[model samples]
Target: MNTFIKSARVLSDGQLPKSGTIYPVLFMISISHLLNDMMQSLIPAVYPLLKEKFGFTFAQIGIITLVFQMTSSILQPFIGRLADRRPKPYSLAIGMCFTLVGLLTLSVASGFVPILVAVGLIGWGSSVFHPESSRVAQCASGGRKGLAQSIFQVGGNAGSAVGPLLAALIIIPFGQSAIGWFALVAVLAVLILVKIGNWYKRQLILATGKSAVSSEAVHGLTRRKIHTALFILAVLVFSKYFYLACMSNYFTFFLIDKFGISVQSSQYCLFAFLAASAVGTVVGGPLGDRFGRKYVIWGSILGAAPFTLMLPYTNLVCTILLAIIIGLIISSAFSAILVYATDLMPGKVGMIAGVFFGLMFGLGGIGSAFFGWLADRTSIEFIFQISTLLPLLGIITGLLPNIESKREVLNK
Candidate 1:
């Protein structure tokens, strides 16, 4: 049913396909990712200002986040599913348009309802951006899927890290109207996506040749086994993102409460953790390409557990260092886990990306809300003590059957 489709051929992990890694295309995709996520990250950064200007409550603030993120989460798989069935070369560019409008809307929004609508627009844009762009990354990967993914992802992580700093510097000082300035960033993203879209269209034409083969299945897994593995992966994702939510949403609070640090100092400490995460993301994928992904997955998540367990008991210096350690180690697992899943389910790349990315967004949202409720019931320090236990779930990493070993068995 593939229209003028290239033969969709699948290979075992790390095997080179016919195409070569297109770094220019990869860099373009990565830059688009940076611009896209940077715009989205502005919402939370501006929340304090929004509260002061609008006289909004914490409850309303939560509602804003919920609306923005849920749109970002819930619509992904559907868009990905549709794109899988019907590949849209220009969808990336079209998606950026949504972000552009959202930025404009948010900049001028005078009422709470308008702000919600604006954020929802931005979220919907993100839901479209991630899956399609991920597929594009793989197409240009030259079989280096893990490396492509990490490059694409690290851009986002870097953008997320930078957005807050930019907001604090630019938007905070200039006030709400300054949100409009970010529309320029969105416009830059649109231009890059257009070029990527053209490249994707060319790939389509080139791929229509006989060298394109249909997707091959992962060698040894049964339907049941595949499902089981996916479920296990989801559980691990939950553990990683939920624990991350604790750090991302409330780590600053924990530092202030536990060490009586200034808010600015805590933010600096948080940035250190975030920067380490970006580095970990870049490192994990190339390592997965070299080592078996299962080992990387097992090590990345489980290796961080000891540090996480020690975190709550540490003083100021040790706490920051522990957080950085935990961030670097745990962050590596996601790229490995994501690449592993795609290797198992080769034909369903877009769907898998959608589901995993959606889960990350959804679980992080749930974790933030859950911890907020928990912190209310107990103390923030107590919640940190409890959140530290989530990484213990990484012990389940040992349960994942090695896909490479299974492939070897099938070949023999």
Candidate 2:
């Protein structure tokens, strides 16, 4: 026990140390992220079951997501800023406990109100979790920010893919009651986070002051240029995540209505797209490191347009194939865009991560709610037809100033 404590202190504070791409720590956090997001993914994964069980309208479903998202999205930036001032390493474990309770409560919830409460609890946990975890990944990165983010995000993407598959395999058959069993995953994550927290705590004590926002202000940018880049990044995030919201929340319905597929089968298709997204995420970061983030941003967001345009018109097999293509192509933008933004505002890592991630959730919530209303007024098919146009806004990518060359100069 003494050895364990001593080792923990050393590893956490300074022994292992942040150097060149700490794989072990990176992978540990990545796995924790997988567990964290896998649990989150369950919310959407069981939507078909939730709708049927509750006699919910599409709009109600949208509201459910909004509540969850608003609770999760709004708090991130503030918490991120606070964490920058005072590091709370153990907060990660405490956050997971919220999820554990929320999952258990969801298992037993009988009505819409209780369901909201449960999901809201989960969302609050998420709001606390992401900013800190993102910082942890960056701390562990040594210097490979893009690769670390990719590795971290791939875990989330994989978890997002797996959650639906798990829901289809486990929860769908056993009913919502089965969600209780997943609390074990939360427990497991807490254990991992406990160790990570100890390390983080030691780092805080030792930190003469290494924070997530070391490079908060870029070297050669005007305030106006910074704001312009940030706004552009936000627009790009809106385009990406909103389109994603349509699929993540409503794709099952689209498949059910159009192809007459089983809930399980539709989930399998969504899993395929999410899995492709994971692959894209893994590729994008490394590619950006080798190439340039701007090129990656342009290619990822714009290159996906053709497939997005084709999705609404395709048959079932073609639709599934188009989805995979779109996921693969478009999914690459996030890490690239995020890293680019971080480069733009190096000093505000926690704040920037929180803002972008929060926007990802917030925009997704709005999109889900909007599309849900649209679906009720028109059709799920119609919503897809309209959503396909969003990626066209990627043309604005051209307006982004070339920062990669600037970064290389700074590195020299």
Name the 10 consecutive residues with the lowest summed lDDT in model 1: 7-16
lDDT of 2 by residue, 196-289 (tens): 8886666555543333223334448898998998999999999999999999999999999988999999999999999999889998988888
Error of 1 at 263 (Å): 4.0
Error of 1 at 192 (Å): 0.3
Q: Count the backbone clashes (under 3 Å) in each candidate.
A: 7, 6
lDDT agreement with native, every candidate = 0.80, 0.85
Estimate TM-scores for all models.
0.91, 0.94
Runs of candidate 2 exceeding 4 Å displacement:
1-18, 209-218
Most accurate candidate by lDDT: 2
Model 1, span 270-302: residue lDDT tens: 778877887788988898888778888888877
Model 2: C-alpha RMSD to truth? 4.0
lDDT of 1 at 61: 63
The residue-level lDDT of candidate 1 at 408 comes to 61
Candidate 1 Cα errors over 4 Å, as ranges: 1-17, 52-59, 260-262, 408-412
